[model samples]
Structure formats: structure tokens, C-alpha cells
Target: LGRIQIKKTDGTLILNSLNASDSNASIKGLEFDKSLIKYQMYYSGNAECNDKGYVYLFFPDPNNLNQMKLTFMQEPDIIVSCPSGYKTL
Candidate 1:
């Protein structure tokens, strides 16, 4: 029941409102992996999908990682990504 939501400017990656806990769901275009230890959300086109991809990893942020919003890039020109380990309300 998730949907593609926003598109970032920098990487032109698609951002989506995906449920990380949904084992049957796909973030960006990859299968949802509950064991992926997602500390941060990633939006990239290079992630398995030819156009969109989402990855969850610990991004290096000065402030609290949870306090920040999703990050994006404008190059790959083809995919969508989202965060994991937490439900988007």
C-alpha cells in the first residue's frame, strides 16, 4: 500500500512512502530486508532497480541521524528509495 511521493533535486531520485516493516513490500525497487540494519535512509537510482532504489544505512550526520530528513542525488536518473526499520506514521 505504499506509493512514490517526492522527487529530490540533487540526485533526481524518487522518494517514497514505504513501510519498512512490510516484508512483502518493495522499497524503490528492491525487496524489503528486515535484517538490513537501517540506521539511515538512502535514495539512489543505482540500487538494483534500473530507475529507482532505496537503501537504509547509517549516514554520517553531525546532528542526530533521526533528526534529519531523507537525502537524495540528481544523477542516476532512474529510481526511487526510502527508509527502513521505522514506519512512516
Candidate 2:
């Protein structure tokens, strides 16, 4: 699996791939208040394709709103296929 980190500073958005293999990932856009972070990612080789997705961070605790929790969403085209007995993860 690959990992990425998103950051916002002075109205600027930054995306960093925690692993070298994920360097192709990049941010497409973001909401003004930084409530949403959108990015597009590409997959090749065994899982050849591309998709768009977004990550949102929410705070569950009303008292500690500074806490962070992450959620990821993506709607991919049906062009992707996995080998028999294997599933997308």
C-alpha cells in the first residue's frame, strides 16, 4: 500500500507521498475553507487505470475540535479489473 500526506499553509495546499512509489499522486483542487482536499491518482501495471478522489478530515469531539480524523472517497470507472480470486483494495 501507498500513503500520502496533505497539508495546508497560508492558503497553499501541499501533497507529499510518504512512499517513493506514490510520487505520481497529486492534488487537483481544494475547498476554500480547507474542509475538502481533492486529488487524482494513477495506477499502472497489474492495476492499470486512473481515478479521482478526495480526503476529508473531521473532528469527532466537539470539545477537542483540533483532533483529526480522515476519510477517503473515490468513484472509479469500470475500466479497472483484477485477476480471479483477487480483489481491489
lDDT of each: 0.41, 0.46
lDDT of 2 by residue, 1-89 (tens): 33555566675535455554534434323443434332223222223433345555556665786776655565455655545565322
- RMSD per candidate (Å) reads 11.3, 10.4
Q: What is the TM-score of each candidate against the true structure?
A: 0.25, 0.39
Instruction: Spell out the clash pairs found in candidate 2.
Output: none
Q: Which stretches of candidate 1 lie over 4 Å from their true place?
A: 1-4, 8-24, 28-49, 52-54, 68-89
Best by TM-score: 2
Ten-residue region with minimum lDDT total, candidate 1: 40-49
lDDT of 2 at 4: 54
Q: Write the per-residue lDDT of candidate 1 for residues 1-89, one digit (tens) a residue.
A: 23445556676645555544454334343343475434433343234334333444443455665653443333354334544343221
For model 2, where is the 10-residue window of minimal lDDT?
Answer: 38-47
Predicted structure 2, TM vs. truth: 0.39
